[model samples]
Target chain A: MHVGIVTQTYQAKIYVTLRPSVLDPAGTAVQTGFKQLGYDNVGPIRIGKYIELTVSADDEDAASQQVDRMCDQLLANPVIENYRFDLQLAPTAGAAK
Target chain B: MHVGIVTQTYQAKIYVTLRPSVLDPAGTAVQTGFKQLGYDNVGPIRIGKYIELTVSADDEDAASQQVDRMCDQLLANPVIENYRFDLQLAPTAGAAK
Candidate 1:
């Protein structure tokens, strides 16, 4: 039985931000709401969606190609939102690492 | 100059939920906070981290395997947090699909 794992990793340092000159009404609303709730330390809260996936495959290569295609096609909006992804493969049986 | 796009796709349905029997103080607090903010429709807001990545790979296979290893090794917490990832590959040169 072959197993494969798909994982997406985002450190706290990663942030989703709007273009400098662009206006962000949603972000502004969240910021105001946070202040009203007594969260003084909350700075400009730039919110972005984070998504990770796990997939099983016969060959890791084929699986990877399919995944990349999904992104450019429908997942991330290249015009307003930019995203990055990482893939993790299960170890082979006979190979000793 | 081959480009491999690492993409993580998540639908709104994906949620991070605590075990039914387990105690979740964080969830409780958030729920209370939402109610106070006039979001009466907000149910239990389960918060989880979403991460996506983009890497340039020489070959799709090698890239896929390497990414899988990173996930089980570090990214997703197998114990409490579970994650799923989707990969999308860029089109190959001189190959019409």
Candidate 2:
């Protein structure tokens, strides 16, 4: 027997980064800090941001599908940044998001 | 033969996420979006942030050391979030960060 009273919920996490061809001023600053610390071997770096989404969907595939669309439409700038995400299901409402 | 004029630089990327015990309002909003979209199976989610650094260090260990300190002191709130980082060396300055 299936319980139709409640549906499944999922959690999604996304990571976004600047494209290799772009500049990262923040990353450069971090490099400079290492130099000042006398550890002058740090390499060039790129900076990025992360986003997490809590969604109600039929399943993982559907949740991923919706979030992917979200990423394409507003989360990442395809011309300058690249992104990846992960999704997991939650069985309880106590899992705060 | 060695040139003391320049030091090696390393690129660092860090991901910061809240502890399971913490609350995430931003993630919750994402979940509600799914509910409104008619896909009421999405679960609770956790939100986090990312950071990247271009550092000049003597070696990977050294860069990691300094960055670890930076995370502890500024990048993450240990009481609510956890962090991890990755580092790579670059041979040329053209690798913008």
Candidate 3:
């Protein structure tokens, strides 16, 4: 593994969520916690997964396409989970704060 | 157990991360994937969890304190994980896009 070097790449953030029609037990449990806390005005909650990845691609469109492939193949379950992403130029290692 | 009612509340987003000293196998695994994909310039990768919730609070400070307490109590493991959050006056339910 290489270290201490920065390279130009694409940064992708993928959010995976259950289909709206599907029940999210964990989300309901959190909402219940709010209910018990007397946050009666609090709204619906959905628990989902967020993934950040860096990949080699020429441009945003290319990076997004690759990320979509990755999501479809392994990152998200198409049967119940839907995924969307945002992309930007990758920052150097240790640059994020 | 009410549904379809939009209310004014505080929206909180919590990001939980492993301490810098802690080894993150999942993150390493993803880094390896990038290595195999020839993204040698791709930098360090860290994987963490993101959580969102709505709560009743008089203001942002109140909402943040409640979220901090929740993080300390049950939302995150203070021993090896660090947590931070962002808060905003909540938009109506289903307003997120």
Candidate 4:
């Protein structure tokens, strides 16, 4: 069986945020905490998404397209949060090539 | 055109680790950091994956199956690290139903 695992590799991303309009106490707390820690140079505490995922396709083009669709159809709530990410490809290990 | 972001929202998981045998300086640093924070009740700080995603499909079953395949073919590295996640579905906004 071709057992495998999916992570922040391949064709995806992980998004996090403060549920819409909900007070971001964590973000505010962190900002205050940072100030106390002597890092007063930070900008407005815009706490938002943390995205991670991996993609698999016959090639990169199709993977990108499908992943884009997946994102639109599901992953992110376009109204509230913003996201960023990194991509990586993991080569198969100990497998007959 | 429909545009979206595929985060750790649906049909996915994010697998993270210290890059296979690479010393986890951050994890070690965090463990120590936590101890200094007076949280001596913490464990070995086995830090790993953080996943968030959203899935949309005709329904749930097909999405789950396809996501499983996507993961096996790409998202994760079976050789190292560990994975976990959460799934949610976002309804269309400001659209005629």
Candidate 5:
């Protein structure tokens, strides 16, 4: 009899942001809009991308490594952006099915 | 003698995500792209907005309130998106000057 390997589903929250040295035109534009809306005190706003995804892996370590590889390979533009992620065990794996 | 109130600067990290009932076309497109890149194990991807901004306020409570108002008014679309934020005291207030 062969036993099936159980895989756990993990939820990852990834944040991709422009490097400080890189210019953020979109952020500047939004700040200007805020000022025009009478939020004169708001300034230096920066915008970034937030992604949530589910991955199935054998363990937490495997899940984290997978997320890291995904970010480095396709989620972030290395030259001008910085990426970080947090991984946690999903409350339930049923949704991932 | 008149004393000046020293306002502390707080940094807010805001996340805006689509509601569960809403469809995420961009996320689906990205998931397809990931599969094309050979990340077959990744699925159910959702994309959203992340924002960082500094607000000067008398205290943490005031800063939190300000961030909440900003999210409700400008950072997120209530019709389909939900917003949450984390506020912390900035390491230095000089940047906001």
Candidate 6:
């Protein structure tokens, strides 16, 4: 008897943000822009990166681990930033590709 | 009797991404970096912006509306990007200020 192992595709949405102690000049600039545009009620904006990608793996745990490694290696700078991600099973169309 | 209208504070996390049809050079560059670092399994990476800010409003709906307006006015580029946001009640520490 022959068995087949099908790899599942997971979609990951990763958010990388600066550590609270880090200064965010871009965010501060945007806050100033908001005030100039009459959005005076807006307060204390901090900016970060949002990344979306797909990974094919044997299971959800494997996919999550791979994503974590990727973040540590390249997606985020640990000294100045932190990252969190959400993973979902990719749609059938995406999996087929 | 004085009727008090205390404004509630909401924290908003906004994501702005390029439309699928638009080309993303930065994403492609990052993908190449991932491949060079031996993460060849990664696929179709896209990079975007994540913004966190606080808004003071009368209620949840009011907060949502204000955020949507902010996105249209200054946070996102309507021509080639799409935006979405999640709103939560600010913590007691944040709301107190």
Global lDDT scores for all candidate models: 0.43, 0.71, 0.72, 0.44, 0.87, 0.90
How do the residues A72-91 of candidate 6 rate in per-residue lDDT, one tens digit apiece? Answer: 99999999999999999888
Worst 10 residues of 3 chain A by lDDT: A88-97
Instruction: Give the worst 10-residue stretch by lDDT in candidate 4 chain B.
Output: B88-97
Candidate 2 residue-wise lDDT, A1-97, digit = tens: 9755343567667898888888888878765765676544445556677776566666668778888887776667999999998888754633423
Scored on chain A only, each candidate's TM-score is 0.57, 0.80, 0.81, 0.53, 0.91, 0.92
TM-score of predicted model 4?
A: 0.35
Among all windows of 10 consecutive residues in model 1 chain A, the one with the lowest summed lDDT is A8-17
lDDT of 1 by residue, B1-97 (tens): 8756533221111122233455556656655754575434323333344433333344556546544543444444566765555545533322211
Which lDDT tens digits does candidate 2 get at residues B1-97? Answer: 9855444567677888888888887778765765676545445656677876666665668768888987887668899999998877745643433
lDDT of 1 by residue, A6-49 (tens): 33221111123344455667656755764575434323434454
Candidate 5 colliding pairs:
none
For all candidates, state DockQ relative to the true structure: 0.04, 0.40, 0.31, 0.02, 0.74, 0.77
Ranking by DockQ: 6, 5, 2, 3, 1, 4
lDDT of 4 by residue, A14-89 (tens): 4445455656665566557545754433223434444343444444555466545544444446565443444445
User: Which of candidates 2 and 6 reaches a greater DockQ?
Assistant: 6
Worst 10 residues of 5 chain A by lDDT: A88-97
TM-score list, all predictions:
0.37, 0.63, 0.70, 0.35, 0.92, 0.92
All candidates in order of lDDT, best leading: 6, 5, 3, 2, 4, 1
TM-score of candidate 1 against the unseen true structure: 0.37
Say which candidate scores most in lDDT. 6
Residue-wise lDDT of candidate 3 within A1-97, one digit each (tens)? 8655333477887777788898889888877886686556556677777677677655567767777877787667999989888988876533432
Deviation of model 4 at B77, angstroms: 24
Cα lDDT of candidate 1 equals 0.43
**Regions of model 6 farther than 4 Å from truth:** A1-3, A93-97, B1-3, B93-97
